[model samples]
Target: MRTVDLEVVRGLYKKAGAARLKLDIAPRFKPGDRVKARNINPPGHTRLPRYVRGREGVVERDHGVFHLPDARVAGQDDRPQHIYSVRFSAQELWDAEAPSEDSLNIDLWDDYLDSA
Candidate 1:
Protein backbone atom coordinates (compact mmCIF):
# COMPACT_ATOMS: atom_id res chain seq x y z
CA MET A 1 0.00 0.00 0.00
CA ARG A 2 1.29 3.42 -1.00
CA THR A 3 0.54 6.71 0.74
CA VAL A 4 -0.12 10.07 -0.86
CA ASP A 5 1.53 13.29 0.30
CA LEU A 6 -0.29 16.18 1.94
CA GLU A 7 0.70 18.44 -0.93
CA VAL A 8 -1.07 16.17 -3.37
CA VAL A 9 -4.17 16.07 -1.24
CA ARG A 10 -4.09 19.83 -1.04
CA GLY A 11 -3.65 20.12 -4.78
CA LEU A 12 -6.59 17.82 -5.41
CA TYR A 13 -8.78 19.89 -3.18
CA LYS A 14 -7.48 23.04 -4.78
CA LYS A 15 -8.11 21.88 -8.32
CA ALA A 16 -11.36 20.21 -7.55
CA GLY A 17 -13.62 21.67 -4.94
CA ALA A 18 -14.29 19.90 -1.66
CA ALA A 19 -16.90 17.87 -3.49
CA ARG A 20 -14.05 15.63 -4.54
CA LEU A 21 -13.25 15.11 -0.92
CA LYS A 22 -15.73 13.47 1.36
CA LEU A 23 -16.21 14.89 4.86
CA ASP A 24 -17.14 12.50 7.62
CA ILE A 25 -16.05 11.90 11.22
CA ALA A 26 -17.57 10.85 14.52
CA PRO A 27 -16.37 12.89 17.51
CA ARG A 28 -16.20 11.19 20.89
CA PHE A 29 -14.74 14.20 22.70
CA LYS A 30 -15.63 17.85 23.07
CA PRO A 31 -14.12 21.21 23.95
CA GLY A 32 -12.32 21.67 27.28
CA ASP A 33 -11.73 17.89 27.42
CA ARG A 34 -8.24 16.62 28.08
CA VAL A 35 -6.70 14.24 25.54
CA LYS A 36 -3.42 12.83 24.36
CA ALA A 37 -2.13 11.68 21.03
CA ARG A 38 -1.89 7.93 20.66
CA ASN A 39 1.54 6.39 21.16
CA ILE A 40 1.91 4.00 18.28
CA ASN A 41 4.36 3.95 15.40
CA PRO A 42 2.69 2.00 12.64
CA PRO A 43 5.13 0.00 10.55
CA GLY A 44 4.17 1.87 7.43
CA HIS A 45 3.65 5.63 8.01
CA THR A 46 1.72 8.29 9.98
CA ARG A 47 0.95 11.98 10.18
CA LEU A 48 0.98 12.11 13.96
CA PRO A 49 4.37 13.40 14.96
CA ARG A 50 6.63 11.65 17.45
CA TYR A 51 6.96 14.89 19.42
CA VAL A 52 3.21 15.02 19.96
CA ARG A 53 2.92 11.36 20.90
CA GLY A 54 1.65 10.93 24.44
CA ARG A 55 1.56 14.71 24.87
CA GLU A 56 -1.42 15.99 26.84
CA GLY A 57 -3.58 18.78 25.51
CA VAL A 58 -7.02 20.30 25.76
CA VAL A 59 -9.62 20.21 22.99
CA GLU A 60 -10.37 23.80 22.10
CA ARG A 61 -12.29 23.64 18.86
CA ASP A 62 -13.80 21.26 16.33
CA HIS A 63 -13.31 21.50 12.57
CA GLY A 64 -16.00 18.94 12.04
CA VAL A 65 -15.74 15.88 9.71
CA PHE A 66 -13.43 15.46 6.76
CA HIS A 67 -11.83 12.80 4.60
CA LEU A 68 -9.56 10.51 6.54
CA PRO A 69 -5.90 10.67 5.58
CA ASP A 70 -3.23 8.05 5.88
CA ALA A 71 -1.54 8.77 9.21
CA ARG A 72 1.87 8.83 7.57
CA VAL A 73 0.80 10.88 4.59
CA ALA A 74 -2.08 12.96 3.24
CA GLY A 75 -3.88 10.47 1.02
CA GLN A 76 -7.60 10.91 1.21
CA ASP A 77 -9.95 8.13 2.30
CA ASP A 78 -13.68 7.63 2.32
CA ARG A 79 -13.67 6.98 6.03
CA PRO A 80 -14.97 9.75 8.28
CA GLN A 81 -12.43 11.44 10.53
CA HIS A 82 -12.99 14.15 13.09
CA ILE A 83 -10.61 17.11 13.02
CA TYR A 84 -10.05 18.99 16.24
CA SER A 85 -8.08 22.03 17.16
CA VAL A 86 -6.28 21.11 20.34
CA ARG A 87 -4.46 23.65 22.48
CA PHE A 88 -1.24 22.62 24.15
CA SER A 89 0.25 24.80 26.81
CA ALA A 90 3.72 25.86 25.76
CA GLN A 91 5.06 24.49 29.00
CA GLU A 92 3.21 21.20 28.53
CA LEU A 93 4.31 20.66 24.94
CA TRP A 94 7.91 21.38 25.78
CA ASP A 95 9.57 20.84 29.12
CA ALA A 96 10.98 24.32 28.96
CA GLU A 97 10.17 27.75 30.31
CA ALA A 98 6.86 28.75 28.75
CA PRO A 99 4.39 31.43 29.63
CA SER A 100 1.71 30.06 31.87
CA GLU A 101 -0.91 31.34 29.48
CA ASP A 102 0.92 30.69 26.23
CA SER A 103 -0.30 27.76 24.14
CA LEU A 104 -0.23 26.31 20.67
CA ASN A 105 -3.23 25.21 18.70
CA ILE A 106 -2.96 22.21 16.39
CA ASP A 107 -5.34 20.46 14.08
CA LEU A 108 -5.28 16.77 14.84
CA TRP A 109 -7.04 13.78 13.40
CA ASP A 110 -9.43 11.70 15.45
CA ASP A 111 -7.30 8.56 15.55
CA TYR A 112 -4.33 10.56 16.79
CA LEU A 113 -5.98 11.22 20.13
CA ASP A 114 -7.33 9.40 23.15
CA SER A 115 -9.02 10.49 26.39
CA ALA A 116 -6.43 11.89 28.76
Candidate 2:
Protein backbone atom coordinates (compact mmCIF):
# COMPACT_ATOMS: atom_id res chain seq x y z
CA MET A 1 0.00 0.00 0.00
CA ARG A 2 1.79 3.15 -1.25
CA THR A 3 0.15 6.54 -0.94
CA VAL A 4 1.84 9.64 -2.33
CA ASP A 5 -0.39 11.97 -0.28
CA LEU A 6 0.58 10.25 2.96
CA GLU A 7 4.27 10.50 2.14
CA VAL A 8 3.93 14.19 1.34
CA VAL A 9 2.17 14.89 4.62
CA ARG A 10 4.83 13.05 6.58
CA GLY A 11 7.58 15.00 4.83
CA LEU A 12 5.90 18.29 5.64
CA TYR A 13 5.64 17.39 9.29
CA LYS A 14 9.29 16.39 9.38
CA LYS A 15 10.27 19.81 8.02
CA ALA A 16 8.19 21.74 10.53
CA GLY A 17 9.46 19.67 13.45
CA ALA A 18 13.10 20.71 13.08
CA ALA A 19 12.51 24.12 14.62
CA ARG A 20 13.83 24.74 18.13
CA LEU A 21 11.25 25.70 20.68
CA LYS A 22 10.83 26.91 24.25
CA LEU A 23 8.14 26.36 26.85
CA ASP A 24 7.01 27.51 30.28
CA ILE A 25 6.69 25.10 33.18
CA ALA A 26 4.71 25.61 36.36
CA PRO A 27 5.13 23.98 39.74
CA ARG A 28 2.91 20.96 40.33
CA PHE A 29 2.41 21.13 44.05
CA LYS A 30 3.27 22.81 47.30
CA PRO A 31 6.10 21.79 49.62
CA GLY A 32 4.32 18.90 51.33
CA ASP A 33 2.32 16.97 48.72
CA ARG A 34 2.95 13.24 48.71
CA VAL A 35 3.46 11.52 45.33
CA LYS A 36 4.37 8.13 44.03
CA ALA A 37 6.33 7.15 40.97
CA ARG A 38 4.39 5.95 37.93
CA ASN A 39 4.40 2.25 37.18
CA ILE A 40 4.56 1.39 33.52
CA ASN A 41 6.48 -0.61 30.95
CA PRO A 42 6.80 -0.42 27.20
CA PRO A 43 8.94 -2.23 24.65
CA GLY A 44 12.36 -0.72 23.97
CA HIS A 45 12.53 2.04 26.52
CA THR A 46 14.71 3.12 29.47
CA ARG A 47 12.92 4.62 32.43
CA LEU A 48 13.43 5.22 36.15
CA PRO A 49 13.49 1.47 36.66
CA ARG A 50 11.28 -0.98 38.55
CA TYR A 51 12.63 -0.85 42.09
CA VAL A 52 11.03 2.51 42.89
CA ARG A 53 7.45 1.96 41.76
CA GLY A 54 4.47 2.16 44.12
CA ARG A 55 6.65 3.34 47.00
CA GLU A 56 5.27 5.93 49.42
CA GLY A 57 7.36 9.09 49.67
CA VAL A 58 7.17 12.68 50.88
CA VAL A 59 8.04 15.84 48.98
CA GLU A 60 11.21 16.75 50.83
CA ARG A 61 12.38 19.59 48.60
CA ASP A 62 11.49 21.74 45.60
CA HIS A 63 13.88 22.92 42.88
CA GLY A 64 11.95 26.04 41.97
CA VAL A 65 10.56 25.34 38.43
CA PHE A 66 11.49 24.37 34.88
CA HIS A 67 10.20 23.42 31.42
CA LEU A 68 9.08 19.90 30.70
CA PRO A 69 10.74 17.71 28.08
CA ASP A 70 9.17 17.00 24.68
CA ALA A 71 8.88 14.24 22.06
CA ARG A 72 12.56 14.71 21.12
CA VAL A 73 13.35 12.93 24.35
CA ALA A 74 11.81 10.07 26.30
CA GLY A 75 8.84 10.85 28.59
CA GLN A 76 9.00 14.32 27.14
CA ASP A 77 5.98 16.59 27.24
CA ASP A 78 5.95 20.31 26.52
CA ARG A 79 4.33 21.69 29.66
CA PRO A 80 5.05 23.50 32.88
CA GLN A 81 6.32 21.01 35.43
CA HIS A 82 7.65 21.37 38.93
CA ILE A 83 10.65 19.47 40.20
CA TYR A 84 10.96 17.99 43.67
CA SER A 85 13.06 15.76 45.80
CA VAL A 86 11.07 12.81 47.08
CA ARG A 87 12.51 10.73 49.86
CA PHE A 88 11.94 7.01 50.22
CA SER A 89 13.36 4.60 52.69
CA ALA A 90 15.87 2.16 51.25
CA GLN A 91 13.71 -0.68 52.45
CA GLU A 92 10.73 0.58 50.51
CA LEU A 93 12.62 0.77 47.25
CA TRP A 94 14.66 -2.37 47.71
CA ASP A 95 13.01 -4.91 49.94
CA ALA A 96 14.94 -7.48 51.95
CA GLU A 97 18.50 -6.57 51.06
CA ALA A 98 18.05 -2.84 51.69
CA PRO A 99 20.04 -1.32 54.49
CA SER A 100 18.16 -0.07 57.54
CA GLU A 101 19.86 3.29 57.91
CA ASP A 102 19.61 4.85 54.51
CA SER A 103 17.14 6.73 52.30
CA LEU A 104 17.16 7.66 48.64
CA ASN A 105 16.70 11.13 47.14
CA ILE A 106 14.68 10.90 43.93
CA ASP A 107 14.27 13.95 41.74
CA LEU A 108 10.97 13.83 39.86
CA TRP A 109 8.84 16.06 37.63
CA ASP A 110 5.31 17.20 38.52
CA ASP A 111 3.70 15.04 35.86
CA TYR A 112 5.41 12.00 37.30
CA LEU A 113 3.33 12.04 40.44
CA ASP A 114 -0.03 12.65 42.13
CA SER A 115 -1.57 13.28 45.58
CA ALA A 116 -0.79 10.22 47.65
Query: Number of the top candidate by TM-score?
Result: 1
Assess every candidate by TM-score: 0.70, 0.60
Task: Give the lDDT of residue 67 in candidate 1.
Answer: 56
Candidate 1, 44: how far from true, in Å? 2.8
Best candidate, lDDT? 1
The lDDT values for all models are: 0.77, 0.67
Model 2 agreement with the true structure over 3-116: per-residue lDDT tens digits: 779777778766653432334555666667777887655444333556767677788987756554532255656455566888888887877578887899887767667778
Off by over 4 Å in 1: 1-25, 71-77
- Candidate 1 residue-wise lDDT, 1-116, digit = tens: 55888977777765544532344445878998999988888765566777788899999988787655563254544456778899888888886788788888888878889999
The total number of steric clashes, by the backbone 3 Å criterion, in model 1 comes to: 6
For model 1, where is the 10-residue window of minimal lDDT? 16-25
Clash pairs for candidate 1: 24-80, 45-72, 46-71, 46-72, 47-71, 47-72
TM-score of the candidate numbered 2? 0.60
